[model samples]
Target chain A: MSVLRKSTVALVAQRAGVSVASVSRVLNNLPASESIAAKVRKAAEELGYVPDAMARSLKVGRTEQIALAVADVGNPVYVTMMHAVSEVVREAGFRLVLSSTGNDPNDVVELLDNLERGYADGVILSPLRITDEIIARLTSTRLPVVVIGSLPQGVLLDNVRADSRTGVDIAVARLKATGRKHIAFVNGPVDTVPGSARLTGYLAAMESRGLPTTADMQVEASDFTYAAGLEAAQVLTAQATPDAILCANDLLAVAVMKVITSKGLRVPEDVAIVGMDNTDLADHANPSITSVDLGSAERAREAARLLLARIEDPSRPSETTVVSPWLAERESTAEGASRGKNVKARKPELEEGVS
Target chain B: MSVLRKSTVALVAQRAGVSVASVSRVLNNLPASESIAAKVRKAAEELGYVPDAMARSLKVGRTEQIALAVADVGNPVYVTMMHAVSEVVREAGFRLVLSSTGNDPNDVVELLDNLERGYADGVILSPLRITDEIIARLTSTRLPVVVIGSLPQGVLLDNVRADSRTGVDIAVARLKATGRKHIAFVNGPVDTVPGSARLTGYLAAMESRGLPTTADMQVEASDFTYAAGLEAAQVLTAQATPDAILCANDLLAVAVMKVITSKGLRVPEDVAIVGMDNTDLADHANPSITSVDLGSAERAREAARLLLARIEDPSRPSETTVVSPWLAERESTAEGASRGKNVKARKPELEEGVS
Candidate 1:
């Protein structure tokens, strides 16, 4: 306990009769022989070497820390994106600070206040739904911020957005190619930006295909949770068992699949299931769900790059970048020759029929 | 833009010639009269009212902010626990601040330093592996901290621990009951606290059941990741298709399941699968995975209670509390009399096991 007072790796190395680098290597588990590692380990044990990270951070003028705020971290897509972001940030010599706002505009405001005081060099925010007031407050600060979603018009900022409209168009086109006329769109809350955008995209795609979307074919869930999705699916399935079902997100798609399977319905054979956000769960599901890759890794990388740029120069004119989403065909959709081809290469042809 | 600054419920109430409470009710759509609701809506539009969260946080001593620091935020179990913790904390008037250290000890030190800057009133930390130095540093601090996993021996601190030993015991017991003589235990890094604990637990459970264990039966993965689990499973499966496989965590189990399925084997029928951490994925997996419920909600509640108590009375004697884990039987485990009961009803009998 008394050894904790020094709080230096050098003191431990000196006491152990070894170089500081050797001790550090052992602590970090770097390559070293058993004998040298043994000695360094013994030295560290005797001296109680607790490294002073604060002193190092202060000296570096960079805490190697970045804050990430999301409307909900529970969403599998967001969780997958966070994992990628953390991996890249760690590789780039930075720690990740996470915050969840529960999709509440006020929660985001509270998080920003703490972010200002958290000593993080940069911040990445993924607001569930964007509002003018939230945008104004975010833009008020010159702090390095990279929004993971689109901002409202007139509020310029560094952003990495997912093109869900194109994603929905691709899903509809694939379903249409399978000769599925009646397609049901199960949505989350329409007030949410993604929900509204996906619903609008679904309607536009249906209209472009010269297909009439009956009111019964479109249903909105109270929330984005699996239970909500299941309930929405119940209503949609009751109206008419469409040959194809398109979900706004994977969670909803998963629920739809579960309900469809429970009723002894075969996917693609009885009903084609397509989900947005090709999360890990989609790959791990029973039938290996077909989904649209919203480019989570790309979004994360772009956000990190933008945040770095903003941290380097806060006064630069704000910019927004949009990443395209592509369809990932799997067992959920009907197997065909177009299944394995890269969706991006076929995007133009697919969009022509749907958009 | 000027109108946006003046947009608030108070302003709307003032303009509409109504009480602030009435404006709030109308804005919330809580059974307000058509005339008053219309008037309030028109006034709110005219004023451009948006609630100011920053001003509110400043007025309250509590920013409603709590920080959670984990070795890895990307892990599904941690993500689920965070979601549950956030839900609870939000209900109790607190927002969560998340920080990931990528399982690096140095990052933990950095997180502690930043915590002292008063960004959050309390912190919940989940270190990947505990060392003496970390325990000493954490115990020395007067700040309130609730460690999500085990701490060092003889250190009096508030703790929320998962009973991995019991979880392992149940898993092994079930496999043994299913006549799995050649049981294999796949673990992550033994140097890690969980790896070490679960390994010891597996050995102890085997010994108690009079089951012979061999060195080949115990395989260690590089890390607690999906790829590592797959690689480890390939080794374990190559030797013999063990009647049952018990994984240290759910991700490992999912990976093992994938490998087994790819090899043309069915879960439970060919190879029984059991994993710890009954995460959301467990319920949604292909066969609906069987897992151990580590009482995450209970652990969270206890951790919060202990932290608040410590904050209230730092001079009080420190304590350690262990939250028990239960076995959740799903499609992975073979259906038998043992699997008929609900998870809550059957508690794994804990025998003397090394920590």
Candidate 2:
């Protein structure tokens, strides 16, 4: 139970024996005599009265707080983005608030409603699913917002996104350079923006390289999860053994790598693998999976910068910043036996002990 | 360009042709006539007058938001805790706002100031360095807060912590049970809470096992990062090779494992390793480093639960919940040559191919 009623401006005024206007002026640091200010301050302190951030926010029109909403924080990719965004926002002298939509549609609706209610000065949202309703709501919002993912055509807003098309192209090109003619594309659900973009990019990249595109060689995971990637890869490998597999994300690539290796396949030697979103996992993997760097940290930093700009000048023309993608080659796609030999030599030491 | 000024309660009242009290009654869903409510609702809709959540929060004395302050989200351990805490907070119908103090003393001070200003209804914090000043401030906080770390003697607050002493004891015991006598303890900075506790635990466990705790076997990392771990390991190994090494965290263990293996020493056979905080990285490591499960997820969930309970009943006595720790055995502590043979056999097939 609340120990006492929350102290209000009127309560402070009553205790200070002053007018409500005088109390507000003193508390807000408006033009007030030293005596009046001291009296108000003493009264507020005595009554444990804190000028509510919310109430002051209503009068000031800015909370000095920015909200960064993402799909999930459990995913390492988003975790990195969150870290980068928080650092940038904090350095700008703004308190950062984080919210995870948890892939819930209702959470998205609630997020829009909360933003409209002025809980934050500005917002940076990375929506997993884009819908007409969300677009309509965002279009009419009074507060400045920056989206961290791809938006539909003609939906105007400040956006910072990755070049997933280029990311997938880089991964495919790396596999092709390793003399892998028969390559398979393993992707997450087609409904997701990244999933769909990477899939289309894979097909285009393969076609551009004069490589055969077969329906049998394309596999879709249920989601961007390790288990889903393993299940999907098992099905694809059972049907046909491609010389190389391009995964949509790092988690999928690592899981696919584990599956292939467990089935007695060697990376780079039997089937080369490449992942996208060059996360820490990509580097930590046994073969250190080759990955396409989509610049997650840069995307988040740019998104925070864009939102700050919009907050400062709401009338400025909206801009879209796209971070470039590049390939990071590691042992996963090494063309020699030296790297594979070392990994194999180290493997038995672990297997004999525990996992 | 500028669109228009934000609509106010007075503007809505004017448009509805009703008193401000009536407009407020209709908007707040207090007592109001159907006709008056209809008129106020129409006026609000037409003018796009979104009720200020901040102002409403002052009146209701609840923001429906919870703050979670962590040291750094970039650390995978904190990321895991954040995910669990966010899930619990969201399911409880409260918004979770994250703040990373970044190991800055001023940031922690600012956090207390912000909370005192009524930024959120409740708070759950995981402080890296717990000071007496912080404990004093928390003891008298007007808002409900739960700390996800150990508290000092006689200090009272809602707290949820992992038994790191037990966690370290289990790791050291397991190492000794596997015939490893020359044990080393590689830890982060001793100034931090986890660092000091884990260090104490290591010494106590060693003493209990009758293992000689030599100065050469004790190494302190500059920080918890992989680079620091590698540097500390390089220094420790350079002095003398320990048969087994117990790390304070997974990042250190992984880095040290790389260091040990690169030096031509086999894991378990020459130098076994055990890490604390059984994060995903532990399992993903090449020879999957054995680790201590500190139950970070459980601590977060318990902290959230305690904060909710305190919020619901502010007069209730503060409670301290401690989560137990367990050991997760992996490949770094394995025994024998049979597993190594199979890995060697798989290496040649990939080498013969294009890779």
Best by lDDT: 2
User: How would you encode candidate 1's per-residue C-alpha lDDT over A99-164 as one tens digit per residue?
Assistant: 777867987777777666544778898888888777877888656788988677777789889998
- Model 2 C-alpha lDDT per residue in residues B1-355, reported as the tens digit of each score: 0122223766787999977556654655544679988998888789876655423632344566788888876577887887787778767667787777777666776787776665687889888889877887788888898999888867789998889999999988887766667789999999888999999999999999998878988999988878898899999998865778999999899889878877877775567899999987787676778999999999999898888767655767989999999998998887442222212322343223221
Interface RMSD of the candidates, in order: 2.0, 2.1
| RMSD (Å) of each candidate, 1 decimal | 15.0, 12.7
Question: TM-score of model 1, chain A?
Answer: 0.77
* CA deviation > 4 Å runs, candidate 1: A1-65, A84-94, A116-122, A142-144, A178-181, A210-212, A334-355, B1-64, B87-94, B178-182, B334-355
What is the lDDT, from 0 to 100, of the residue A61 in candidate 2?
42
Worst 10 residues of 2 chain A by lDDT: A346-355
Model 2 chain B scores worst on lDDT over the 10 consecutive residues at: B337-346
**Model 1, position A216: C-alpha lDDT score:** 92
